[model samples]
Target: MFDGMVKIVLAGPVGAGKTTTLRSLSDDEPVSTEMPLTDGPMGEKTTTTVALDFSTVMLDDGTPLQMFGLPGQDHFAHMRPIILQGALGVIVLLAADQPDILTMCSEWLDAIQSITPDTPIAIGITRSDQARDFRMDALRALLAERKTTLPVFTIDARDREQAQQLVRALVYSFA
Candidate 1:
């Protein structure tokens, strides 16, 4: 069994499934600071995470993991660093169907890297099933352009197995 807890931050644009991913991986009830969405173009979804989401999960090796999901909306961007404090790694989620996927990815990556330059990062492309022409190449090229190469996975945020895989990848990157 591994000793101590590892903190990981999950960040992405609004509606990228950060909360859903946490819920999938958490062993306990996840605490979320979600409130009804009053603005923005988020269709169908009524609530938004105003602060953060917190959850805990124990790995197979008994390492307790503290998972924190950052609020995706730009107005809450200030909370990113606060939530990311002392995190061992970061998981960036992007909806495959988003028209601005590249930009969104770049923005989140920049923010995380700026705060924790050496922190391992894993990118998870969510909503792949809804994207007809999902372009992994584009994302890879973006990472390459930034002079960084990291594990990128296509995942369904609501799938426990997929979400766990993301967490595993982030942990393994620390090796």
Candidate 2:
């Protein structure tokens, strides 16, 4: 039933693995960073996603996904409204180890809610394998307090299959 292209934005805080997630799902090698950082919290990292990064993939029903990833920084927050203009949904990446993740999720939820209240939003808790596994109930409760009713799961960004499955779950929910 997904005929026309679906634009999906991946939003999260810095080091939440937004870039890595974009790299994993696309058919291609998932294009590299576009713009360079002049002066930002990102500092002078060799790899910095300044503007927005994009990649695409076909759904099982032949629908095209115009996957767009936004730089996970307050400086880049301005781009969300524009990038989310026609987005079908969003994949919000969150690194549990980072204490600021809850704040990041809250901010993004507020931003995206204004654009599309019904827009499907899924949270991916990255780096679960690195840190002690947190309770899924606690994670769900956190999201519930923000008024976001969506599935939240732990994910390893490095594993292509696991990452793809998480995305697939989100897509399937839309159906």
Highest-scoring model, TM-score: 1
**Clash totals for all candidate models:** 0, 0
lDDT of 2: 0.76
**Model 1: colliding residue pairs:** none
**Model 2, range 91-157, lDDT digits (tens) per residue?**
8888877765666677878888888777788888887776675456776777778665687778887
* TM, every model: 0.92, 0.82
Error of model 1, residue 22, in angstroms: 0.2
RMSD of each: 2.0, 3.0
TM-score, predicted candidate 1 vs. hidden true structure: 0.92
Best by lDDT: 1
lDDT of 2 at 80: 83
What's model 1's overall lDDT? 0.89
Which regions of candidate 1 are displaced past 4 Å? 1-5, 59-63
- Model 1 / residue 90 / CA error / Å: 0.5
